[model samples]
Target: MSKPTALIKFKAKLSRPATPKGAAWTFLVLPAVASAKLPTRSMVTVEGSFAGQPFQATLEPDGQGSHWLKIDNVLREAAGVAAGDSVALEIAPVEKEPEPKVPADLRKALASNADAKATWADITPVARRDWIHWITSGKKAETRGKRIAAACDKLACGKRNACCFDRSGMYSKGSMGAPEAAE
Candidate 1:
């Protein structure tokens, strides 16, 4: 994929989470100046180049009004960079929204309910993203299962969006923030 003309550009050192909560992933927190240039202080999709490798991702809010990018193992390998490496980045919000992959649990729930499945198929990709985000945002397995059930019930009732979900996590009780860096 071609890299978009960068609206924001900076160099940041990647870090790993101190706790087990997000240890599987590496993260880079955008500088305050760089993060401020993005469209919103919320989760937003952007197509960017990390260490010269092209990638598209949804940046998560850091709860400090800045956003942080999660660098998966694949990207890290491809980019030839790892935690503690300061790599160059260039990013811009995607003009066209990308569809989020449906989790297996949610997919199974929707498949079993004809009404929900039909509604899911009819909703726009953006709406589908909201539902998926709402479901996946749960911190526990039980919470996720409950969300899947709730999602199906709401979809069956023709709800087009995950009502009142705080995509930004700024106001929600479960405020999504960047994980603390490992010492």
Candidate 2:
């Protein structure tokens, strides 16, 4: 299908979790624009400006049929926005599929594991993205190495991606916790 290029403009509130222990995430929940029904649980590249700072990111769908525009620290600082702030956003969906780059360590591990390599090749792009995300989400080198090993083991056993990992931010358990759970 041809990727639609209509510019979606909206006003969104910058929100963060109320709990102190929750992830320090800030984002904008985009409203439905035009006739396009954004896909659930998939990455969609968006090019836009949040409060005037240009940005390009792959927006992750929240299982509930909404997409979140995660505002990182840099973006927040640049935009001079914080929790409860309202900002104007302009975005256009890019048709290109985001290709998550495989870390060198994970690439080496996958190369050494023949079964894992074959399984990785057979899995869908979304599944591959999950595996790549899981492998790279580790905060430390040791943690990343362990995740890579675990991924190979799971793939060798015919598993497509990490178990219990929510590729969609709706129920993420990685560095950032579930967005809904924080609310």
- Best-fitting candidate, measured by TM-score? 1
- Candidate lDDT scores, in order, read 0.87, 0.74
Q: Against the correct fold, how does model 1 do in TM-score?
A: 0.86
Give lDDT tens digits, candidate 1, residues 111-181: 89999999999998878988998898888999999999999999999998999887677788655788789
Which residues of candidate 1, in runs, are more than 4 Å off?
Answer: 1-6, 21-24
lDDT of 2 by residue, 6-122 (tens): 687888778885555655667766665521445444566778888999998877665544677777888899988888888998887756655677778888999999999999989
**Which residue pairs in model 1 clash with each other?**
none
Name the top lDDT candidate: 1
How far does residue 17 in candidate 1 sit from its true spot (Å)?
Answer: 1.2
Specify the poorest-scoring 10-residue window by lDDT in model 2.
173-182
